[model samples]
Target chain A: MKLGFLVDLNLCMGCKGCEVACKVENEVPLSSWRLRVKYIDIGTFPDSSRNFTPLRCNHCENAPCERICPVSALHYLENGIVNVDSARCIGCAGCMMACPYGAIYMDPETNTADKCTYCAHRIESGMMPACVVACPVEANIFGDIEDDSSYISRYIMEHQGGVQVRKPEKHTNPKHFYVGGGNQTLNPLAHQRIEGYGLFNNITHLKHVGDPHHGILDRFLAPFAAHKAVDNKSFMDFEQKKADSHDKSHENEGGH
Target chain B: MVEHGINATNAVVTMDAALPGIIWGWMITLNMWAKSIGTGVVLISAFLLYRHKKESMPSIRWIMPLISFVALNVFLLFTLVDLHQPLRMVNIFFHPHWTSAITVGAWMASLFTGLITLLLAIGLLDAYPDCARHNEIAKTVRANSELYEKFYPFVVFLAIPVTLYTAVIMAESSARELWQAPTELMQMLLAAFMAGSAALVMVSDKWSQEVRKDLALVLAMAVFFSFVMYMGEYFFSFKSAEAEVTLEYVHSGGEYNVQFWMAMVLGFIAPFFLAVSTMKSDNKTILRFAAILALIGLYLAKDVWLKIPQMLPLS
Candidate 1:
């Protein structure tokens, strides 16, 4: 059937609804994502623009992960969907090494390699992928690309000259296509990543133990507990004072 | 005045967390290093046996298998432990995917180990005939020298692929620009010879000086070529941007700078000089020292090469 995905960058907003929906639908563990929305700031402060790109597995025709998987845990489904059988996986992380797009992740819970399977279960049940359903702007389009009547095929036909895939030089021949996406947005290497405390950053805090509040008691009793503890009253007062001062300065500038 | 825009790069990833650093760590390094020793001994020992004949080296038959069996076990152990689903490793055998180099390598290694075990048993029986005389099976096997000869060639042939398959796996790894197959294949082969010869020198204290000299020569040649290849990549990796970025970790004052250079100097350069000196002066002490250094250096080199490439972020 040659199932394919298309993400129209033109219509996509940075809302990340699809990302959340996919996580919720798949029950993807904390800090592990089947789909992620990346924000790239382009140009100078005054003339700058931000690009929002939803990145996920491309499900290449010649999949490197499938080829490198020792146990055939990752195999192509009958409908051209690259499916993963986590039960069969030995968790060698070989697929992680072979996926150029960094789509594959070792599930912290299962300790097995997992990736976006184009929502194969949902596809078999005759439903669209969760990401496609959740995309408020209808940016994500999923259908059988081989069928000329399918939406994805028509989309491909419409954007024949403009369609792009990530890392085409790798010769993966990805079934996923992007329309109206710039190089800076599609190409991972085109930008320098900022390292700091942000969403999906600070991975040490994302350790997926069974208990949600497992280490809280231990952390509270640990060495230098008082020193590490936040003084909420003092911090709030300081923040209030800072806000007041900032308002005064802005008012003074306005007066001037 | 343009404050923010001037000289600023067009795109900066303001939000993302895709960096998975150094997934394959020291365990993989140890796996490759030990595997090299395991396969290398078989390869070099076969050559030595062919040159000197089976009758002359009575101790070598048992000793070669013993070394190979132990080293291969270590290799297999580390490989097992490194896997997140080590208990599920039986899947590789039962539900094997032949297209994967890892699958092929695993099967070959298992078969190779099994054959090495058989050889070890035969060698033990042949060496200690008095002890095993009551076991007619041992006597029958020992009597049939041709059986040993048949197994020897298989070990030799299997050793080459068992050592080289890792390179194919490395090459197959997507976006790892530093691990090109042809060069990696050469490096793996050279490493096998270097490690094999060094190991032989360490164990072959009782063997003839001529044999020792030949081992030293092999060690020297292997070191020289391997060093040249390393240097070639070190200097000229800029052809590929990703490789250049990866190599940055091993560049001067980089994270792996000291380790990489130390490996090159200690493992390859030092051994080359010592091996040549041993060849000329027939100095057993120098030969032994060089072999020790070479083995240690090989481990360090493998560690540096394995780790540095992984430092570069794929996404």
Candidate 2:
């Protein structure tokens, strides 16, 4: 059976109950985390919206981290769960570098690569993941996706139109799915400008979008941009109208 | 701003990506530098012997093997000490993975160390062949000098890959965009050769005009390659947003800008000019100054290379 996660962003309250539960269940170190909440602030000022996305290992079918491990420390179990055999790990940190999601962490205490295992031990005894059970608002859902009658499968089918996964361009075929919000929440790099300090006092900021200095070639290309500006406005207006029509069509379908 | 509503002032985007803790720090960098120098010395010494024949440079006949043996051991020692489980290092040999760069690197290092030790033993026996009359092992070692001379070129060939492997391991990491550049391997290889040659020039008491001139040329090539690699990364930007963010973090007046600029000026530009200016000079003091500067600059460059990439969050 292919196990999967269905996270509903609309239901997440940013209370971090899952984060606390995962730490308590797994006995994760004080400095490390198996699951964490990522707060994304979209737009600016009064027009802005905050999306609290719970981030963890997606357990991708085509996992880059598994392939890049120099030793067989990271491997896939039969149930599609990515397991880390800490006993065999040399703490080379290669898996940490290969993971696009940054799920794996080099645990200094254990001197091995550590990450979420989808609470494999609990699942073996026919129990839900600690994070899934502890979520107060029932935002986190996990079940065998292959079974059409399963909660995760039924929920995904019902909300199939709104479901999305992180970094679809990476072609990892992630088992974890998100409903509500869109690329702004799913794509880690979508927010071009952001500032914050993590729990560990690590600061995050945005990079310069373009080259600071314009060269002679830029000046030469400026006149063509003047012609395109007028056309760009009409093109955007047309796109807005098209989006309005699409929304209306979906509304009619829902009424029926 | 609406009262009680979350705004930019109150909002903070906290990232949960794996941050660079205390692992793979200065110790790893120093270990890599030492390994390159160790391998490089053996390769350069082999070239000198091949070119001038064993009898021509009588001083280097003893000096080269001794220095290389010591350096290789130091390299091996540092590598062992850096491991969290030093005893588990043997696991790399027993359960080897061909796809893993570290596994292959361990094998390469072992082979090079064995060859250098054998070569050094042969050198010591040949230097005092009179001792062979009294000792059986000395006789066997003296007899094997010619055999090892033939094997010396093969060891030198292995040295080149060993030097390149150090950089290849880092470049293989797909997530760190700064380390993923093709030029990184080339840059490290050239820097190793330069550091090795410069270090040799510093320690050697006597240097012939032709030997000095040849080293000057090697130094120039190293500087040129450094410039090419730096420019390649600067101009031909990687398409990913993560790559751009990392590039800007390191290059565009971020915290690492000072260190990056220092590395560029001192490591590449200063050494390039110094080596060029002292090319025709017979003054040993002037040459040593240039050599020392090259070593310092190269070390600083390596420091910046290892540290700056981790500053950017991968996720």
Candidate 3:
């Protein structure tokens, strides 16, 4: 049975308990983490409210990362857990740009990339992923999608499942099934920085748009940019305008 | 007062598109700074080479250490851009989406760093041109000197693009105005070539006054062209809504104002003066200082250009 994680944003209280639990359980370096809680503070000051959503890897069906590594450092196990073999990673930082979700980060200790693995270590030992286990709000749901008895499966079937996926049309089919009204639709621009631990405490977004032609030029530059390999997977969906339009409506609708 | 509200609203809409552009433009800043260092190194080398032309090539045994030390500072500059987890720097690789500028920049920087490191090692062991004939570090360096000659050009070429990649990434982004230059690629190319020539001249030995003057004149001309191109791009970005917001931010004297001024003086004006001063006296020191100033200013401009555009997005 293929494993997967279903994060019901509706239940996530922005408590960051999952963020804390993931760190302590993983012995993650004090400065970084595998899982993070992100909040989007929309509207101007005073009228603005915080929109919190716990974020992690979706164990993408069409994983962009596995396609780009110069060496086969990251792999998706048969059970469908996305994992990294640290020995193979060369500290290249190639995969960070491939992920639309900004889910992965380079581990400073090993100088290799690190992101949520659905807790393969704990899962093999018969324990749930740390975030799933420590989720005081029970907002995170993890299980095998194929088995009808699996909670995630039952949950997906019972409720209208949504997700914070890349423009599925862009081809990275994120398996992180989102619940209704969670993540005011998927918008990376609105994805602000996680606060606390020094510097700006507000949930700020990225520095300004560095490349306006990103939606186009990035694709053109990809082949010529670097030596990183690419998987010629068919990306059946890539409508930047559509995603942008949908994002506009989604944010206008207020907190999901 | 009215503009602030307009800016805040606009920021909300384009935030997604702009963030990556900002991240990638940083590489451009580093490229600029590195070039500045390169200019200083070249001018100094040029002066020394000119003075000691008749003597055996004076051993710049100290160059190896200086390169390493300067490189260390350059390394730290890249590390300064992070927010939450600086150690997770490699995450850029594990999550590769080819479209992400930061990811692409990370790869370029890694490759560039690797090459620089190898060059450093080769230089340290003193293994350039004559290793095969004499079997000594110095001889190897002399024998393999050809190898380094080849290596230098290639690295120069790669470094140049990596330098411009920053600006190109910026020029295309909808986020910041300064980056959207219609002529950015060409502008950067002109600057890199001019700087490259200056670097070569400063570091080369056995050259004549006529040769030095010719190279200096060419570089000055290149600087003039680059300035024109940049001005054009600067104004081009100011005509749009998103771009205009960013353009206004630059004029607002955000954190980058002083940096921009420094770049103008050091990168453009100072070198111009230094190069011109050589016409008055045959002194090498003034020329060296000019070369250093020009290089520093070029880097300053690159950094300010990349970073200042970013400060405008509402917090």
Candidate 4:
């Protein structure tokens, strides 16, 4: 009875169909996504390759996120989906720490944590996730893993492809699987890079929109510290000349 | 040094930060409730002692403090509920997940509260010999002195874990660079020791010299442990990028940040020095203030540790 989505990265068109579909289906506010596509650029410009990774909740069988939620706000269904109950979510973010894959997101509008629920609302009515329907490349395949004849099961058995499971040491036992994939490698912070969707963050929260890797101190303090010194070399030079010449002219007039 | 860049990509770009954020937030919310509860627990104990006028308070002594603690635990229960959709928290208990720490904490708080209540009832039974129904139950149990002595020891033991659990919950989260260390466990343990001793001293009339000495020693040990652990964690983090953010986080002196400093000064250092120097003093007010400070510090420490981590990026 375990229901989940199997995203095939090999067939993905690099279009954020699933992201858009999830937003529309869930009425998710701007910049919040149940699932997202990550683009990784590998090698040099002349001989480079771009990798796209589809990220979603694996719905781990041994969900650590489920273990840490103090109120039991999140629970696993008999069908093996690890979904959050918004009614109880106090907006604490414990599940965020427990989730190693980083699959959960907080929706600012409602101030509640969000994730791919596997479209539990629609699935109960026997409908698939909107992303599955909208995937132009047919990259997203959805069905019950328990059903032996299901497409996902067959795909897994034939190719033995599995989802990009990071931090398996954490043991969340995710149900979502990725097939035939190569994308995202390395920690984004390790490289001192931050890229959120444009206009996603309110302008107030985002002022100096740039990269953080210019300096070690800058990378760490970028969020909380003051902006760098403005480029005023020309202004300084003009001020210095005025100070010298104006002072001399004033002195001569006084003497006369 | 602030790069002023707000556009870096997330290592776990797709991770739903809100989910874990909600859960951790739930634990901290409990700490929030604990802060108020802890304050009331100590203050009420002081008031109760004042009212009883240096007499052997058979039933009323433990009853008041335990009541306050139970209320705190109940507030903790509500926090667990708050983690869910604003309305559907009942499902968690109906379909319980036993392996989760929150569930474990819930059960532990419940069991501890229940035990405290039982201890109080037994004490009450021992107090009134004419309350035949209950005295009969307690008489077969042990000496009245023995019966009188039953619960305080367990409170000490239980308080240890209860105090540490909140910190553990915060520290176990790798997400917050602040809570990721073991120092939180140390902080809780020290604060609990200080709180417990202060509580014990408050309730007693003819203080046991032996118990006083033991408490003094425990107080000293706790002070040392608390300082060592707090410093150890800081030393490690002091050089890290996360540490820089943490320093900035502290400097911001957000409500929780202010709380942490107060906890350090009033909770640990003040009482620590007092415990070392004022061990022989008859002035009880100082001890009470120390306890109050320690408890306040502990609560603030918990809040700061929990909230700081939510601000970090996993990558």
Candidate 5:
């Protein structure tokens, strides 16, 4: 009984209903996400398209988080859902390092590691995940992938070779699948990221807040080498120059 | 203000970013650095005891466990403080999961500390039996030289695992391609040797010149191999794209460029030269200075190595 999740990129309209539903159902705190929609723009201007990729835990068959966890806080249920026992978690963040997909987050309130469980709580009560129920276009398909008659299993069959999973080379064997999204949409490195564009723009330091050595570390490292914050100018400047040149080429062509 | 919407001109507008900032930070770096010293001292002291029994036995017995005990405590303290749920650490021992490197490391480290504590007691009692003249157990332990010998080997054996287990934990980390288990394990071993020898150099004031030369040689060899491993990885990390990307943090003009080079020069280059010089000159001051620099540089190198891989966006 392998539970799975499938997102049809073609059907998703970036409504953000599922994102809201997940937070509400799970009571996720601010600045954290159990599930998220990534908006990646593909191609150049005049031929560009936007892809809404709903990202969440893959609940891998060989989950690294489950293995790296010091206390078995992350364990696989009989139904294949990777569940978390916050009570048992020592909050080592070892799971955070082990999860390739970046699905896990340190819950600010509980001070424990947390992530998408495919809504195991609801599933046990015989209810679908809130994201599935909230999605207006029915883009989210959830069911037993092992059961041939299941909707998710049938969807996988229909899509066949077209289905894609992120970072398959990592060999996590993610249960989450995507249909109709190309490499540009699935691969984060394939696209250009602008500074000050996303959540907490230019605030990559938010990650440091969780460290006990936050302020002291800054002071301690200050004398040694004085490493600057991540150089956003390197990549962002290159991207902006390319975009400007692209616009110039388009204008020159139009003038002709 | 550029919002979460696509501009059609730009390549992407990532609406929701899941970039967890440096999950493990300086505390973790300190943990590894201290552990290396703790384990390295035991390993080196054991070798010295076996090889230079006459010169090293009296001092090394008490000093080795004492140094290790202090450093190991610092390692354990930071490890606890770094955890978001420090109180639940007992779950590691109470509800033991043998698979997790962290759980295994915790148990091994605890047992290692315990053994070191026992060794310290025995060494102190053996060296100064008058301190515990009234205590029967202390007197009994002081007389039992065979028991001390038996326990010493166990501490030596346990030190290797306690030092190497962190590499397994790092290697097991998902998507962190930089921390390959084999390479990391090798690096950890080298770090132990480097740290152990450097630490012994600091306390070898009462030891013979030959023993000092031996410690210097060990420091030089460890530094040489450790430097070679770092350079190899830095130059040849292109085999894996993820590893290449992670190495970008230390590449020329990259974020950690200056610090990485600083670590190389201080930890390996200077130490190597000074250690080699001490072999011929028998200069205690230069040897001690080299040891100090090596320890400091090791901490910096570890800090950079740990922080760089995490800087790469996992999302």
Candidate 6:
């Protein structure tokens, strides 16, 4: 039925309710998350604006993770939900490298790759995803986009040309769509200056802990970590200009 | 350099951005290393066997098969240990994914191992004709030397594919530009030959002048290929910002600068000179040292090649 998510950025309040709800419902470890809210700050002080984008698995049509998986541990269901068969997983982590969205996480507990299953178990029981139900602003919409009568289908039709999918250039043909002003938050490369504060600070921990050469070994292996010096300033500036032009064109198309 | 400061003060914050880390770690690297050595030994031995009617090098004739067999087993062992569900490896045979390079590689490795083991048994039977009188399989193999000789070429053909499969696994990862580069397979092939030849020369005590010359030629080709691949990757500018950053990290005295330079100098430059010099002198120790250096350098090169690509944040 091609079940998908349509996150409306206009209504989101950066409350982080979905993030917490997802964690509680999934029983995800404190060190990892199935979903997260990205905060993007645009412009300077007085002219500044903020955008909150909910990030999760795109459940792509051309799933690279599924293709790259050596043991066929990551597979797609009939409804198009890409799910990981933990029992079959070899913990090779090939899927983690293949996923362009960074949706998958290596669960050290299970020693297997894990990610959002679109709450497939809950959906099979005829319940909405926990994140959608708990979203205070009702910003997280989930339904069968293929079904014309579904809310997601109507929402997509209503938004029409305004819908945005992150990294469309990746050609994953992501099922997750964002409506309204999510340009800044959707493009990860667009974040000019990132402050590792709040939940974002965990990114640093993730980088360290996820590293194969962390702990005592890092003393000897630290020099090989030089690729960490990614100069994204110029790239971010370019992306910011591109996003601005996109916003300008949308503004010309009339207000949301 | 892009400053990744911890203080949030006034900037945007991404809670779940992609982090830098190795997805496939040392286990995969070791597996590839062992597989290359195993395959290369058999490949070179097969070349020698086809060209020379008699056993020109008595030591290499018996040693090469034994080494190839042991190395192949090591490759298999590492691969199994790396799996989360080691028992589930059999699932690949039952539920094969034809599209997956890893699936093909697994099958290729299995076939290569089986063929090499059989070939080793045949070689052992031939060497100790008295042992063949006792065992039926050994007797059949020893009696059917002509048949085994005919199949040697086919085994050699399988060895090349099995060796290249290691490289193809990395190159198939479309998400990592550093791996997906067209020259990755070529680089890997060259390195494998270099490593394999170096290892062969290190263990073999007595070899004919022609055998030494052949090994020298192989080492030279390896160095030449490395130069071409490195220049192509290092000199050419990448279109993608992420790719450019990754290439810069590899070449621009970044974190892996020491390892990279070490690989170039020790693995390629030094070995090239040592191998070339062997043509004028019959110094076995020089060749052995060169082989040891090349082996170490190739491993370092692979370590850099595998680790840096993963360190680049994909999301």
Ranking by DockQ: 5, 1, 6, 2, 4, 3
Per-candidate TM-score, chain A? 0.78, 0.75, 0.70, 0.71, 0.79, 0.78
C-alpha lDDT score of every prediction, in listed order:
0.83, 0.71, 0.56, 0.58, 0.84, 0.73
Q: Residue by residue across B123-190, what tens digits does model 2's lDDT show?
A: 77777767657787777778677967687788888888888776777765655666764667787677
Point out the worst 10-residue segment of candidate 6 chain B by lDDT: B1-10
In candidate 1 the C-alpha lDDT for residue A84 amounts to 94
Model 4 chain A worst lDDT window (10 residues): A204-213
lDDT of 5 by residue, B1-315 (tens): 343434543457556654677889899999999999999999998788777866544487788888899999999999988888777788998987788999999999999999898888887777776896988887777777567688888889999999999999999996788888898999999999999998888889989888898999999999999999999987898877778877875685778889999999999999999999989899999999999999998999999889888877666
Residue-wise C-alpha lDDT for candidate 6, range B1-315, written one tens digit per residue: 123432232346545544536666777778877877888787766655566544467766557777888988998998876665456678788877767778898998898788777778777777777874987777777777765567677878888778887667675576676665457777767766886787678665776767766777687678768866876776575766656777776677778888877887888889888888986785788888888888788777777777777766544
User: Candidate 2 vs candidate 5: which has greater lDDT?
Assistant: 5
Clash-forming residue pairs, model 6: A90-B84
Global Cα RMSD, each model: 9.5, 17.6, 14.8, 14.3, 10.8, 12.4
Computed on C-alphas against the true complex, the DockQ of each candidate is 0.31, 0.13, 0.06, 0.11, 0.32, 0.22
Question: Clashing residue pairs, candidate 5?
Answer: A98-B174, A207-B21
Worst lDDT window (10 residues) for model 6 chain A? A211-220
Which should have the higher lDDT, number 5 or number 6? 5
Tens-digit lDDT track for model 3 on B1-315? 654563244223221111222343555357455544433333334434445452333334335224533653464454433222333445566755455444465577567656555555566556334334555655545546456445655555566556455454444243343455446666566665555545544553445565556556655666667666656655566554434655555667756667776777676766676666675564556666666666666776776666655544321
Off by over 4 Å in 4: A1-14, A29-32, A37-54, A69-80, A83-97, A105-114, A120-128, A139-163, A176-188, A191-256, B1-93, B118-187, B199-214, B237-262, B280-289
Top TM-score model: 5
Interface RMSD of 4: 9.7
- Cα lDDT tens digits, model 1, A66-154, are 99999999999998989999999887888888888888887755567898998889988999899999899999999888899998899
Better of 3 and 4 by lDDT: 4
For model 1 the TM-score comes to: 0.88
Clashing residue pairs, backbone N/CA/C < 3 A, model 2: none
- Docking class for model 4 is incorrect
> Candidate 5 on A47-141: residue-level lDDT in tens?
77767989999999989999999899999999999999998988899999999888898876556899999999999999999999999999999
